[model samples]
Target chain A: MSTATTHTSAVVHPEYDRLALNRFGLWLFFFSESLIFLILLLTRFYLFGTSRPEELNQTLGLAITVILLLSSFTAYRAETAIAHDDRPQFLRNLLATILLGTLFLLGVVLVEWPEAPRLGIVPQEGFGIAFFSMTGMHAFHVLSGVLLLLMVYLNGRRGAYSSDSYWGVEASIKYWHFVDVVWVFFYPALYLL
Target chain B: MEAKKAAKLRLGWIVIGILAVLTAVEFWVAIAINSALLYLAVLALAKAALIVQYFMHVNQLWHKEGHE
Candidate 1:
């Protein structure tokens, strides 16, 4: 009995190790991706010097900020619901997050860009290039996040998560919120300053 | 247990409300007030912190043991 207990205590369930390992790996990936955004910010400041285009629609920027933040809240709700074993609420909130995220991408790519041309806006040296590059990169992240959220939502609808094993929901929501956090910085940087 | 979760969910709404108000303030400061770039940067960092903490579950970075 003593030897058996020792053996049992020496090892943990693989699920625990797997979850911890996954979290570590995901965060490592985030850290590396942060470098790319950092370069974008550096490039923006290097090029613009504290000045941005006044014609760059602050109103629409604010609107995009609001929608993306709303999606973060929805993502939070989805994770929380799954933590409590509420599958239906989890599914609904995840879908809401995906929808808001998609709208944010559209607001940037379709609405913001095409509208820029009509505003008599021109790249004007490196200004427009840097601005588009920064926002475009962020838009890419948003698009990827929306796709991931859809996968999570679909898996969740099939009852893949539970109160005890909801790491899938947690990881996806973390990614969603990370994307929102990036926009919190990017919105002000691109549109405000 | 259920009640605790319900309470947490309520807190989620409150966090988003704070985020909304902060973004509005960012809009005002950006154009109307014309605050310094440093101030805007600070506001952006605050917003990021709120999302990462409450929404991203950064606090749970080491909580996977209990989760699993």
Candidate 2:
């Protein structure tokens, strides 16, 4: 009897199965979010054609892209650290991600917005509306992502996760990467192409 | 197990390096090959796959017999 139960249990990992369900739900959320971004992207092409405002800063656009990409890397590092039960490394990387993400947002809200004329964002036209709306939505996602990371970091600080169970970390990271992926498209649409 | 985990961590850095190089290429294409929208689109898809397949762990999504 004991052997039978042990054999059955050995072939099954219910915790992981549950985690997979959560992952599924998150992916569904991402799919829906993609629809929203798709419309924004389409609007970019429809409104601006192949040309962007001549005033846009290619350098700042690239800088923000690099920052967001580096933040994605740090988020990956944090996830990997937590997977190995390295709480300190996880915390450090999480902080770095938050800082980098916030910097990206500030670059948009503070510097980028103020330099609208130079960036070719005319508030009175379709160009301004589409450009700001696109970046603003992405910035909002980044803000939510930063909040999510902070929540995960707080829980992680209390030793809420371990090598065997770190679904919170996993969930946060997938979403963060999605935000980065969105920017990968948005950067070119708004600044360069 | 430990060795495999270490390799996985190193893979993260490898993926990041690839992404950086691709981004540089994107910038070059944007400035130099201004008419190459299709090329940019393809590069964007490739960059997306790298992140999704690796960082997002999409490969871990399915399993047949094993519950884990």
All candidates: DockQ: 0.73, 0.49
Which portions of model 1 show Cα errors greater than 4 Å?
Answer: A1-7, A122-124, B63-65
Off by over 4 Å in 2: A1-12, A118-120, B64-68
Two-chain DockQ for model 1: 0.73
TM-score of 2: 0.91
Location of the lowest summed lDDT over 10 successive residues in candidate 1 chain A = A117-126
lDDT (tens digit, per residue) of candidate 1 on A94-147: 999999999999998899988876776555655788877888888998888898
| Candidate of highest lDDT | 2
Give the distance in Å from residue A93's predicted Cα in candidate 2 to where it truly belongs.
0.9
Task: List the candidates' TM-scores in order.
Answer: 0.92, 0.91
TM-score of 1: 0.92
lDDT of 2 by residue, A89-169 (tens): 999999999899999989988988888856566666768988888988999999999999999989988999888778878
Q: Quote the RMSD, in angstroms, for model 2.
A: 3.1
Whole-model lDDT per candidate: 0.83, 0.86
